[model samples]
Target chain A: MNELLERGPEIPAGTWDHDWISSVVAKAEEYSGRPSHWNGKLYEQPGDVAGVCLPDGSMTISRKHVLDQARPAYTPGETLTSDQQFAAAEATRMAVFQARHSMSEVGDDSLPGATPLESLEDIALENARCDQFSREYSGRIAESMTDQSLPLVAQAPLFPAYSAATDRLLYTLGGPTGLSHRRLGELIDSTERTQRLNAIADEALDHEVGELVPESHRAELREHLTGPLRRGLGGLTMTEMSELTHPGSKHSWGWDSAEWTEVEFSTNLGDIKAHYESWEAEHPGEEPPELPDSLRETFRDREEEIQQVWASKGWPAQQPVVGREQAYYERLPDHGPVTARDQEIAKLQQFLWSHTAPSQHTDSAVDTGGRPDNVRQIGSARKHGRGVE
Target chain B: MDAYREVQRLYAEAMMSAASGDELVAELGETVQRIGDLLPQTAPGERASVLLMNSSLAERLARLPKETR
Candidate 1:
């Protein structure tokens, strides 16, 4: 009967039969005796036997009431009336158990039995393999998305196992010939390594240029260079500025003037100075005007020459020189004495004023230093002038 | 051991039987057809067959020629 039931389909619902329920209830009764409240209390109701609760609202009981009320043959499988359903469900459950056991025995030769720990280990290993596969697959997918060739170093993590997989793939797909896979891989790896090093060097340079350079020097260098350096300055120090500014120093750094001249039209100071000196030397015969003191001496000599010439020519002269005397006055470096010229002009004006009106003696003769008699006669005439008047 | 060998043999067979095509639409149809062939509804179980179908499809796709894929 077990074989027959086991071979049939599994029961689809859960229910039980009345006979099974009654038998289970009888077993329960046999074990516990008549239903009663297990707890002992002093105020007991008339119909409350030990622990069992009566169906009427008047009686109270213990947990025995709940247990007694349960139908015992409730199993899981078929749906039907209690008696028929319980039988079918019980049969189905027994059939399922037997079927599992028989099938296990039949397949025992093929199945590998493992302890729980061994099963866990196997699962862990499988999970690891799956993770590795997933990682490789994802890496490949990422690599394929771009057409541009990645630097060999950047491509390393994407193809962890093989060194030249990318290059090999490229070569296989009608790439340049005369390129071995190993050589190509090495080339790419070296190229990418170089690129990475260069990038690192660039970043370091930026930091040095931006932060390490002193503010004053940086501003000066900026003005000198006119802009940022295109080729890096190779970590030059401030002390190198002396070498940089020297006339023919190899260490001197600057833009190529010849190259930049087309854009910058201003004449350089060096060129201007050179041209000025060359012009002066070319016209050596032409001298700049003499210093102011030398000019004053020359003017005085010219004045004497003019006076002698005027006397020899008998040109009517307005004033005669009493004496010729050299004059000296201290002056600032660029300007001559202001007070001395003012004093000289005042003396001339006073002399003119004294000579303009004749005294009471009406003598027209000029004062030549040789004429003392003439001066005496004029004096006498002045004394006798009142009587004649 | 026999069940393991059978599983491996069936997997390899399914992988070998997968179709190849030049067009994406054709390849997709071939993939579906191969999966359906490897996983018939009449099989006693569904889980193992479904797994086998998926794995076989993946293997076939991987082995496909670049131009065809």
Candidate 2:
């Protein structure tokens, strides 16, 4: 029995001993029914293949050939290549091998005692458990990585580019060498475990969490956690923009009053009004005119326009708009003639006159209302003259 | 294995089990919290040291207190 087991298989001794490359070529040739060449070298048997080759010199039988060949049986203690799947049967074999080894190493006197047969059975069961865990866990990781509703900012790391403004990390995984979803998931799982254990150590160390974790390890953890965390926080909805900008706040996006100042009439007018009233009270002597309802409505309507104007000019919130307003009026260049019943013109003239402090002129009240009848007759005569022409 | 290695092994295995980004993140969070729990309540600098040593773990830990409670 010992001889039978020991002589199970031979590599057919050759110049090369690396098993993997030999197997790859041997398997390729077996599938193709022709000699296989890798980077211009030939491998006739398992033991003749080199471990590594220059990139340009290696070429194998096409992938199609391998699928046609009979699949090899795998047993525990054997490391599979990266492409090999850990099927249930293989997992069972590995489990059994592990159990037997563990039991033998620990010895019969140890708490569990040696029972190779029973240990093998237990291994089978454990493999099943692990398979289920892997299936469920992989599914979950895939779901999180692919969920699109999680905003570009939050999803940036998981996707491709990392944007500070959006708090997103995104990058393309379509290129060569990018892991498939399953493999990438496995990698994520591996890193995640290290992260958790470190967390536990961090808690234990408390004040010494940073000291406990090496700087390099910390950087790795940061790379892994940053994306998921940014995504998670990106899910939060702020009822108030102020909540975003508060000191030490974790939320990256916030409302700037200037951005919404035009629309403040609708959403934040009450707060603004209260603030204005408070300011007015504090400055007691200055009486500002009450904002008329029409003017307020006009201001509200102009919100979009104001935002566009402000954005175009790159004006700060505190910059006066009076110049812009005057420029706008100047562009129009036409205001109807000033005639009788011009209360506005009269008011303006009276204000101007008061400012001049006329020394000799008697302070006489000007009755501008009487000129409206004469102005109406003149307009009628002009229309009659145009009709005659 | 050393405690750090052991803990890291378990953490990596747990992470592999994570099914989604949320789950992965949650698992990361739990791991950080575990570290936090195990951490000694020494000086702030000491606490920071524990976190800084495992910066990834520390970052996850930092995010948790603000988010979970």
Per-prediction DockQ comes to 0.01, 0.02
What tens-digit string does per-residue lDDT give for candidate 1 at A121-213? 121112222222223332232123222221212211111111122222224312222335444322322222213212222322233333333
Please list the residue runs of candidate 1 whose C-alpha ends up more than 4 Å from where it truly belongs after superposition. Answer: A1-128, A131-389, B1-10, B14-32, B38-49, B62-66
User: Candidate 1 chain A: minimum summed lDDT over ten consecutive residues — where?
Assistant: A230-239
Candidate 1, DockQ to 2 decimals? 0.01
Docking class for model 2 is: incorrect
- Winning model by lDDT: 2
**TM-score of each candidate structure, all chains considered together:** 0.13, 0.14
Model no. 2, DockQ: 0.02
